[model samples]
Target: MLKTAGDRPYRGRLAPTPTGRLHLGHAATFLRAQERCQAADGTLIFRNEDLDPQRCRPEYAQDALDDLRWLGLRWSEGPDCGGPCGPYNQSERQPYYLEAWAKLRDAGVIYPCTRSRRELRERVAAPHEEDEEAEPLYPPEWRPAPGTGQDAQEPGEVNWRFRVPDGERISFEDELAGKQSFTAGQNFGDFLIWRRDGVPAYELSVVVDDLAMAITEVVRGADLIKSTARQLLIYRVLGAELTPRFAHCPLIRDEQGKRLAKRSDALSLRTLRERGLSPRQVQDMAR
Candidate 1:
């Protein structure tokens, strides 16, 4: 069983993808994490979610660290600090994910999903055009059955998906958004847990990491609210004690009210540094 919040020491993390340069959104989330940790007298760990090796650049990873440092953010331990979680990069933790995947496989909670992205898009779009605004479009038999590897198959041949429990509501109290819930088999159907390319899916990896790190609270952008249900399912499957408290803050939008993206904006930390923006100034802008 997973331990309750009171049963564990307070621990949080600032996990960032190194696929792009650090921007205002990144700074804002990190600042919030730092403040929250300070307020609670807890330790904040820094992790690089650089699993997408193809898009993740070494320079970008270094730049992200430099950017965080420039923002006056300090982590108690990280990849550079050589702490207990020495390898703070996700890429280095593939073995752990593999082990977790095997466990889920043995439990018969995951299944092979042959549907391609294009096929899934068409499935979702077809219902929309038909004005059938109902539940997610997944065949009943397609869902994985607990303790039965009926859908399990060789990797690279088919993608893996988690079988969500039907008619069950996965609900949690958000530190900021109050009560949030999603009907398991209805609102969300079986979802991918591993890619065909042998990469551990984010939904699975994050849950495994959070449990391993003993994180007490999770504070992220409100955009990820939908992901809560999928994550909670993983926690339940693992028989974790209790879900961590969540605080999904508002996202930083541009003048056009669009979420900021690295490709479309010149808000890279290096660019900001070149413009002579001090760490404090950047942090203030993030706020």
Candidate 2:
């Protein structure tokens, strides 16, 4: 877990996506976060990142809570506790995201684009047969004019993107991985802040929620390490406090060294419970 800068009590979070049942991968991260909080006499908040309304289910959210409890993990606050930093669920925190988007707009850091999924995919698939290096190409119009207010355009007409500062390195120290860095304009070009459908994108929403909740540490899977740089830009744009230190735990992988998937039944806590595996056994397996 990321340590606080000083003597301040650490505040960490376990934000689970309720797209499916909690799996072994989920348990491992949750356990780490819980342990970190307990070690610091700190608070661990449970957040439901259930923004994808089409797939997220109330039952799955409840199951997630049950599974965590069954695994002997507890949180200091959640949707049930009415904590100071609530609407613990991302779906319920729309206004917070809207506020963040507005701040980016006011700072001239974001713009609107009109690229479709097919267009983006084709661009990334372009031929590069030569060994000579070439930068990833984004459509010219992808960087929308600042203050265009075109993000208010009709669906499919525009999407919001952050204007990455060219040639700058976005770097941060990870408690587990040590110093890590990425070039802002090289590793990623302008990225979406809002989808064509007007929903705040994950990049923006997660940063906004973390700041609003005053999260002191972000204990998550290593798969999201790349996201830290993007989020740092958001924190910079918003003039929010520096991000909490990050601890990206190793991912849980299958025997083939592939990351666990939603379809991996053997990793599902619910399935393991049905087969009479005790929570202690699951924890041991995760360790």
Candidate 3:
């Protein structure tokens, strides 16, 4: 992942999931990404994170692209226009995930997990949130015996999790959120890189794609700070030569002061457009 002189240029991207319509949360993040790229004299890329075939639909993807264009956002490369590092969709990049999995397997930092949702729910306690909350961290005790060498796992089906050291402290500076730190065992435990369903987890795919796509800065909702910490661990284990900078935007909340969800049709871009709101009006409402 090393870049020679004149090889690195500021690059960023918007990764939208096709699970639902593009909501205000997405707009706030994408707008920030576009502004940052402009300020840095960089290029922007668009990527589709449609890893879940059951939920991801082509119509949703098209609507997302239309919404982005309706907002006057443009990208140098994306699924709509092919780039050198396409296909931009995560579902189409299984080869890269396989390669990374093999690397982690050879390095002995990965192990198979059999813990189910019920098991994790019974073990990991969810902290109460005044507004909204991120995904609960996993408990390391749920893991199988510690991985000691390469090829420890059978090729049979199982969730692949990366082994994180106990009490290891990780620190990183975010371009927007500033200094952030978290302890491995306390903030989160060993996490999944691949699931039994045969798709790479979000943590693995994001890191792999950012490095491979040469994304310079990751612009996302502040809700993913914990995920950032998780991905950081993977970057360390893989010895990534180019880890992108991060910029987490503030989340949009509802009347209850809770973060918005996909079901909140009132805040969706499609609804706003149907209400005769112009791009500038929607931008103003987003702010």
- In order, what is each prediction's RMSD in angstroms? 3.8, 4.5, 2.7
Better of 1 and 3 by lDDT: 3
The C-alpha stretches of model 2 lying farther than 4 A from their native spots are: 1-6, 126-141, 150-157
Model 1 poorest ten-residue lDDT run: 126-135
Ranking by lDDT: 3, 2, 1
Residue-wise C-alpha lDDT for candidate 3, range 120-235, written one tens digit per residue: 76676655674234445677556666564366443247788888777888777877899889898777777778888888889999989988888888999998987888887788
Report the number of the highest-TM-score candidate.
Answer: 3
CA-lDDT, candidates in order: 0.77, 0.80, 0.83
Question: For candidate 1, lDDT tens digit of each residue in 1-287?
Answer: 23347645678888888888878887887788888889899988888888876788877888888888888999887887856765788889887787777777877788777777667766665544222322355767655445555444434556888887789887777777888888877777887788877888788988888877778888887767768888888887777887676788777877887777676447767788889989888887888
Model 1 error, position 241 (Å) = 2.3
Expressed as tens digits, the lDDT of each residue in 7-60 for candidate 2 is 556889989888899899989988998898888899899999988878889999
Q: Which pairs clash in the backbone of model 3?
A: none
TM-score of each: 0.89, 0.90, 0.92
Task: Kindly report which residue stretches of model 1 are placed more than 4 angstroms away from their true locations once superposed.
Answer: 1-4, 126-157
